[model samples]
Target: MSDASVPKDRRFPIGLTIATLVAFVILCGLGVWQLKRLAWKQDLLARIEVLKTAPARPLATVLAGKGDASWTRVSVTCAPGQAETLPLVYGVRDGDIVWRATAICRTSAAGYGAILLDLGVVKALTGQPTPAPLALAAPTQAVGVLMAPKSLGGDRAATVARFAADKPAPYILMVESATPAPAGITPAPLPAEISNRHLEYALTWFGLAVTLLFIYAAMLWRKMRS
Candidate 1:
């Protein structure tokens, strides 16, 4: 081989090394982020467990208290015949497409002017259009968990603002049971448990980072030998 070619082949692979380092840092960062997520998820699951078994508090009382209100059990009564059905929300149940029914109870809670109520889910079978509101039979009394709306980031703030514009509380009341139960709707209670797989995800990312470093070292060794 020519003298110039020999030096070129033996020279350190600066470009490849830089690329590998960048990739390695990114993979490691992902792993660390997942670990942080694991911590947050663990705390969440514990809170859910505590809230589930606690006695149902009045909606007004729960709203007035401080700290995280999500997943809290609450009780409220809707004015007789005051249930106004809202638009259906799309959802999935047991791997099947479904629609969640909801409604607004005017002047329901003693202090709060209104509150959003999650009636239940209805299967969206093929060849069927949106189901009509179930006879506007709003439940007179409902005991359920308070859940945050599904919106994220800026959308979540906007959702809260929109719901609270007239006076409704900013949370959705997932009705577990009601006096004179709602018809044509199956109770869609919260899941018995929430899955926490962040530890597994973090391990996978860390493993990839280690694998990448080994591969890069092998390539460098081969170049030097050649």
Candidate 2:
């Protein structure tokens, strides 16, 4: 015959119980944080997309704030001495591999200081960059969208420092002149605004957290019954 009363000796293991609870809390916390990130990322992407379509403003107006300058358009004056090509970053343009030469430009405005300017794209087929630094003929006005240097690895701050010319702003602006890029270059189109996968990552984190909780509960129930 089966015993009607539960065994008096049976009890939850204190250490295991504590560990499970801690893990459950941590997982749930991560899930909540991811939800918050999802909203923020969505809003940022939307704002950037809008900036891509909006009319261009003066460099000063665009530089007034960096909060939403991800793709904000601006026009500025540039000269050969004011711009220095730092390094090249690569991307696909029209089914062809191309390298973008990002340079730092010290604009005419003293208060605005300097901003990294993306000169434009040089085709991989061009080979070895021709190494002609963006030396403009004279002081010329240019227009572009603001961008931040992207680090494929390591710290972004360090990357920015390496490219900086005379303490430029933390942001980079992809500038294309109304006339044309210097030479061996074409305008680098703005990258897709919403290509970042933060939303998917957030959902994945939330799913993992839910799965962890469900498994923990099942194990706890089974342990109690035994």
Candidate 3:
């Protein structure tokens, strides 16, 4: 290699070295955090698998039982002659952004109030959100996996109103209707989502930290030779 192409005297400055060390420590910390997350996720998935085989109970019965009933499947009845509610949100499926049409069902049960069932989806059109009335106007029975309300960022007042209004079942249920949906609308099935990709994520962060250490060592070697 030409002298011009050679690296000049590179100083291993204490500040740079310290900064790199701090970053390396942070990266490793993140990897360890991910590993802990993996363990928690594994335990959650195991619990869900066990819950699935158990027979469906009335929404009230399941709610009465313990240990975070999120993901427990249940049967619910929609009150007749009530208007369908539409909660507009955006979602991702297979890496594509799609419109989420969540249909709300006002329950007839005595204790719990209302439930939001997935009203399938519509291909998002350019420049505007998909319109309302995307689900059936009639009432029906449903089978769904109950879940905690997804975070709605920082809109606390709106969140309280949206999630707690009309005394919704403590948990949100993404249900597939036992009855047919409105014409042109598809049945939104309950998602069996149990993610355990944290181990892979941890490995990736650990790999990057190791790679960076190697690169730092190579730089030091070149500087010493120069």
Global lDDT of each model?
A: 0.74, 0.62, 0.64
TM-score pick, better of 1 and 2:
1
Selected candidate, larger TM-score, 1 vs 3:
1
Tens digit per residue, CA lDDT, model 1, 153-172: 11333433555755878778
- Per-candidate TM-scores read 0.82, 0.71, 0.69
Q: Poorest 10 consecutive residues of model 1 by lDDT?
A: 151-160
List pairs with backbone clashes in candidate 1: none
lDDT of 2 by residue, 57-140 (tens): 887766665465566777777655644445556455555556666655666553556665666676534444334444333225
> Which ten residues in a row are the worst by lDDT in model 2?
150-159
Ranking by TM-score: 1, 2, 3
lDDT of 3 by residue, 10-75 (tens): 544567578779889999999999999999988877867786586667887787677787777788
Which model, 1 or 3, shows the larger lDDT?
1
- For candidate 1, the TM-score is 0.82
* Best candidate, lDDT: 1
| TM-score computed on alpha carbons, candidate 3 | 0.69
